[model samples]
Structure formats: structure tokens, C-alpha cells
Target: MEEGKEDLETLGEQLYNRIYPSHKEIAGKLTGMLLELPGSVLIQMLQDESVLTGALEKALKALQLEQEPRLTNKNEDEVSVSSDSVGEQLFDLVDVYNTGYSQKITGMLLEQHKDAVLHLLSDPKLLEEQVNLALKTLKEQSVEETDVSDSSDTDDTERLGERLFSLVEQLDVLHANDITGMLLEMDPADLQQMLGDGAMLEAAVRKAQAALKTWN
Candidate 1:
């Protein structure tokens, strides 16, 4: 029985290490996840208060280490201060994805780290540049997959282009924390024309509404 218990403990430690590279790394990841995941999941994960407390404590310690000054040897006679770590890199990646602007990595991160992605929809720092780049990439890929001909086809192409433009505009406005105002200001005909399907439009509106409620 004692041996079995020891084996279980070892397995747990191994699992923790795989999920988190280090105790400090785990702390930051858990803190970020807790801040982002739904309330119910967060509560369930924290049911054992010690688990939550320990992660927080480790994360705080890691933050302190990150803030502390470090000396670097620039040459035989000179020294400089430098700050760098794997934890910092991981945190930076998380920050980029969680800041609301879309990237190709966003979907991958969302799937792999759903708990750490909850509040992304609310970040206003995500600028139009990122959105434009992502939209441009999508448009280029879409165009490559389809071909257009003359006159009537050209008109259809123009209409499709307009719809793409509208989609990007809507995404930018939504990321800028103006979803409700945008929705209210949008003419029903324009919204329908931009979105093209009533069901999809309604679904998008509901998602925006939910995001707003979460923000509030």
C-alpha cells in the first residue's frame, strides 16, 4: 500500500511537470487560466483551496524573480544587467493571444488553452493592424481557392469584396469594445447584406451580447 501511494505521488508530479515546465511556470499559467476560464470551471478547479493557493504562491515568487535585477558579463572588464527566461517567453505568447487581435495561432491556442482564453474577447489593445493583416491573409487564401470571369462575375467579385471589407470592419469595431454601439447603429438591411444569412447574423449578435455581458 505504501509503495502504491508513492507511485501515485510520483505519477502526479510527472503529470504536473508535463503540464507545467516548472512550479513557477505552472503558477503563471494557472493564474492566467483562472482569470480567463468560465466561473464554474474555475470554481471546480479550485475546490481544493490548497491547489489554488500553492499555484498563486509559486506564481508570485516567479514574478518577484522576474523583477529582480541580474548582472551580465559584457566583457572581461565590463558587466551589464539582463532579464530573460523561458517563463517570460511563455507569458508573452499568452499575452499576445489573449489581447483580442486575431492570429493564425489564436485557434490553436484556444483549443489547447481554452481556460486561458476567456477574456480575450474583451481586450481593447488589439489594434486594427493585426485584424487587417489576418483578414488580408484570409482573403488571399480564399481568392486563391476560387476563380472569377467577366462582367457578371466581376460584379459578383465586387460584392464579395465589399462583404469581406464589412466583415473586417465589424471585427475591428468589435475588438475595440464597441460591439453594442455598432450593433445598435447598424441598419438592419446593411447588417443582413453584410452578414448574408439571417441565422448567422443572429448567432453573431448573440455571441457579441454574451461577450458584452461578460465584460460588464
Candidate 2:
């Protein structure tokens, strides 16, 4: 996994060097954004040059947006209350779901419905509908480029480990391998239960992270 991250960082550097030579310093930041993409998406990006270029461009643009203010003072003042409320809800959407692609998918949904974020947040059913729509859109966007359906080759344990690893990575826990190792060491039934329960998995991850922090 660490090796994979290194390869992504290397690719990110190459991407920035090729297209944004003048902004070389931001390459690392762009690379971090690229890492936020699901592992499958990253692999697809590597196999397809067009996909790679497009993803890199999006990362670059995202970085640029962060460095510049998109709204004027008047606009900020007008939306301050709603933005604050909506922003919290958006964050809850991201943090509540342990799905590996929540961050990327949420960003895509926001981009597609910039003006409707507050409106969507107003109703629970509407918010869920939009989120599902975003998830479907993402799956459709990558369905042709990536085939995630096949896993007949790996045993159930291997598949379980892969799923757990992906979820742990999304947690952004320090020493993720340590947490994964702890989870993997559980009784087979217990491990399977945790894997099926996102809330339990998240709680375990947080507990592990806290313990590791204290010990270190």
C-alpha cells in the first residue's frame, strides 16, 4: 500500500511537471488530492491517459480554487448563515459515511449542484436522493474504465481484508496498517461483523487511533 502511494506521488509530480511547470510547488498538494481518489479510480487513471490527464487537471483546479477566493465580500455576507449550516451538513455527509469514495463523490455532487446544496440539505429524503444520484453517476463514469465486479480468484478472507483495508484508508488514521492488523486479528466471525458494520468499523478505528497516539 505504501508503495502504491509512492507511485501515485511520483505520477503526480510527473503530471505537474508536464502541464504546470510554473506551479511546480503545488504538485505535492495536488498529489494529496489525487490520493483522495478511490484506489480503483487511481488504477484506471494509470491505464488510460485521458482519464489520468482529466483527473490531474481537476486536482490542479481544486488547488487553485483553494488559493483564491471564489466569492466576494457581499456574496459571502449573503450566504454566510446558509453556508455555515449547509457546510456542516455537507461535512456530516462525508464523515458519516465510511464509504471510500465519499469525499470524491460529495465533491462531484456539489460541483453538479452548486446552487442547490442548501436546498438539498433542507430535506432528508432529497439529500439522500441526491447522494444516491451522485454515487450512481460516479459508478457510471468509471464502470467502463474499471471492472470491480470480479473477485472469483481471491478467497473470502482475502476479499474481506481488501475491503477492510479500503475502509481503514478512508479513515485517515495514523498507522492505518496497525489498525487494520488489529481488526484482522479478531475472531473470524467478529471480523466479519465489523466489516459489515460501518459504524462499528469507524468506532474501532477511532479507538485504535487514540490508543496509538497515546502510546507513541
Candidate 1, superposed: residue stretches over 4 Å from native: 1-132, 148-200
Question: Highest TM-score: which candidate?
Answer: 2
lDDT of 2 by residue, 130-197 (tens): 76776676556456424643433225445666788788988854455445645654555677888889
TM-score between model 1 and native: 0.22
lDDT at position 174, candidate 1: 38
Assess candidate 1 and give its lDDT.
Answer: 0.40
Alpha-carbon TM-score of each model against the true structure? 0.22, 0.32
Q: lDDT of each model, Cα atoms only? A: 0.40, 0.56
The residue pairs that clash in candidate 1, if any, are none
Q: How many pairs in model 1 have backbone atoms within 3 A of each other, for residues 3 or more apart or on separate chains, i.e. clashes?
A: 0
